[model samples]
Target: MTHQVTIRNTGHRFPAQDGSTILQSALDAGLVLPYGCRDGACGSCKGKLVDGRIDYGRYSEKALTAQERAQGYALFCQAKPLSDVAIEAREVRKAGDIQVRKLPARVQKLERAADDAMIVYLKLPANERLMYLPGQYIDILLKDGTRRSFSMANAPHDDEFVQLHVRHVPGGAFTDHVFQTMKERDILRLEGPFGTFFLRDESDKPIVLVASGTGFAPIKALIEAAFKKGVKRPMRLYWGARRPKDLYLNGLAERWVAEHSGFEYVPVISDALPEDNWSGRTGFVHRAVMDDLSDLSGHQVYACGVPIMVDSARRDFIQNCRLPENEFFADSFTTAADKAR
Candidate 1:
């Protein structure tokens, strides 16, 4: 039996099928909803359940506390409607603006930027272009039924095919395929323009871009977009990596620094092997930020990379660097291989 539910604040009706999450139905119908992660791991999709019953799928308690759930809060990604529901939620704008779409993509080029980093270029058909914000990411749905998310390294301009930076993980499923098995002329299915971690153009606050490994992908896109849009905002980038090899885009960043007057790039190295012949500031990447900027209360930070880096940076920036917690935006790249550890 198809369930009919009235969307809160909408005069229209929706057909809710059994076991399907509310967010999925909204996306399928082009009625976008504010969401992130879509795995019940991020609370970006959390909203009030004004009136309804739904099962809470496998979600982390960190995303939604039991207290919040009891207080009518539900994660849209995990909530499946069992009755007519009224959700007091944010309108599908900004991050939810781009409708989710699946498109045929072909690997146009593969450029190995570093010993362990590869920037893959997927070409779209002439007339098939992905409309994505600067910091959004797309999931390459693999044939094995696994999804790998990568942020667009290039800004969307005149309908260009999407771009992504893939870093090799020691036994990673997707990265291994990308480095060893993937090739040009390869066809893949992609669904996205997802993630809420994008630049807030409205803020003129001094920007601090923090990146680790290939996490710089989205930060690069965001900075490029900001420059292309002629944003004169003073921006400084603090890229942290283990040894110089991790920052494969060092030259590219130097070029950006030379071209942009308001941009500054600082490379922070965590560990330098003795034989590697390294000379750089050595410490936690976030600690480097703390060392440089004593006060980050007025700055907006966009950080990406390992969860440890984001978490550490967030904690330090708030507690030590004086950065407001809300101003610190992060995209944690949690890999399956890291799950075991």
Candidate 2:
């Protein structure tokens, strides 16, 4: 059984399949409804149920309090329509729609994902939550007023711990500390939810996600968010690293490919040694995309990584592959070295 869902302000209507949450069904129908943490932990998906009944699914009390429920507010991420329903929700069309915040987070855990990469998990204060779009980054404030920026690796839905994939730079101050001394329970001040490098939900075009090294962090967030939102658009991810081990989360990406129908993952290694025994695609990551997708005029690309890869992909895709200039979105991971140059 399928029921129709109507947006009160937008007048857009889509069918909610039986047992599917309204948010999931809306996304499947290509609607860009406002949402964060599809797991019912964040109230960003909270909206007024204008009409019709719904089975309010599992959600944290803090997210949808009993008082809010009495007032007709439902966490759309967890609400399944029992009949034709009309809901009031503000669609997030731009980064400006969400607020930027400054908060303190405790380093709950730190584990090395690779020889040069550390996966850092941050826990925000219990009474606070950072509302951010997938693919946005946060800045860690240093005592000297310098800031180190890192993308949030975890999707908004998995916000119990804000995750960051930090690559250690040999002589860099912040990263050296992260590699040498950063420990669990260390408190750090951070500001943001910054950057416009998020998904343009309004577009229904197939997506090409490119990442290099730790740039995979935000890309990971975007992919997880898409899965939770029920986005069915075809997506192919190109993750490039110098060696197989540098593709630290290779297993996780492979799992996504095995589990999802319209998703594909290609791991490219540029400088694999004989010991690495690499059998997969070789060469530059962006070039691999170009070789396979000669025609990208109808596609959208989200790229993150070092400046060279991001710049090359943006230029080549638009010039050679006929991809539209506006369709290219990127965030270049610039280090102190790059800035010096």
**TM-score: which candidate is best?**
1
lDDT of 1 at 149: 84
In candidate 1, position 50 carries an lDDT of 81
Off by over 4 Å in 1: 1-18, 25-35, 42-53, 61-74, 82-97, 158-161, 319-322, 337-341
lDDT of 2 by residue, 1-341 (tens): 99999999888889999999998887677665655445565455779999999999987775678999999999998999999999998764523445667899999999999999999999999978888889988999899998888999999988899999999889999999999988899999999776557888889999999999999999999999999999999999999999999999999999999999999999999999999889999999999999999999999999988878987998799999999977888877766665431
lDDT (Cα) of model 1: 0.81
**Candidate 1, 164-188: lDDT as tens digits:** 8898987788888889999899998
State the displacement of the C-alpha of residue 274, model 1, in Å, after optimal TM-score superposition. Answer: 2.9
In the order shown, the candidates' Cα RMSDs to the true structure are 3.7, 15.0
